[model samples]
Target: MAGLAAAALLGTAFASTDGLARTGIFGSPGLTENDTSEWLNTGAPDFREVVESLRPSDLPLPAGRSWQPVIDQQVADGQREPARMQATGVHAAFAHYAVCVWDGEWLAARQAGDTARVGRAVEVIRGVPSWPIFVENDGGGTVDWLRSIAEAATHGDEGPIRQHIRANCTSSWIGVDQ
Candidate 1:
């Protein structure tokens, strides 16, 4: 079960990168290491920059919707192509944050005395990404890392488990977890 959860999280991470690579914006042929440095200068690298480059800058949404919802709704509404949605600058950060949120929510479910909900979140989190490097490709063994955290949560060390997850996921798109 723990292995499944880690795999799901990692899978989401890689799928996000695959989305960007297919978008033709971030990983353009000429993107040197220096170019990556420049792109990092864009301040708060949300996926909206990719959307702004690909489509009209004036798409309507509520004031505080996350990038995933915007992109997901766009796909659901047939307003944009899957490729466009994947290409959003928000993909990488969103995926990273999603895993963090998934861990926190799952830990909460388990802590709040809802073991069933914890299992469900675990199932979905497993399904989403599989492992962390599937999203970022740091080393490998992210599955083992996730398993350790899950074990911690199962032991009622919810706070530390969440803190560990958040530390692994401090990215530019979403702010650090508070």
Candidate 2:
């Protein structure tokens, strides 16, 4: 999966100038040239900025409804495009952070036992442009890995997630076990 170009995925667009996959925003510290020992040791980087960006500035969840409406409005308004994602190291962070925020919403709903909210979150995520990048090959089509991952995370089960990380890991600097 390393060095995959935008063309590798049908209709997918990569912002990389070299037409190669670049690391950052997607928890690919191992794929980076930075100090591996130092970087990996710090664990996952703080993504508060990306999470905060998804918050509605002037809109709050109305009454008993979920935040999906606001997120949907943002999407329809073209405000949640990939170019609007966290850009600490990416030119456009939408592709990366959209997954993060959606995963968070999914997990939160699952944990709260809110089946309706979980379904709504999943529906919202279905519209995210970058979601296709998270799919993995299966027999007939592809697996929506993010949904499985969110399920795993909500259950505090890292085995499946680790298997995915190792199987798809393209970085040599940091060990998948790390």
Per-residue lDDT tens digits of candidate 1, residues 46-88? 4444433444232222223345643443333222222222232
Model 1: CA > 4 A from native: 1-89, 127-136, 141-143, 150-160, 169-178
Best by TM-score: 1
Model 1, position 92: C-alpha lDDT score:
36
Q: All candidates' lDDT scores? A: 0.42, 0.36
Q: Report how far residue 31 has shifted in candidate 2, in Å.
A: 21
Error of 2 at 27 (Å): 24
For model 2, residues 1-178, the per-residue Cα lDDT tens digits are 2222121211222243332212243433445321121111111122233333445332222124344432343243322222222222221123333344444545566667887877765565444423433332122222345456656655656554455445543223112231
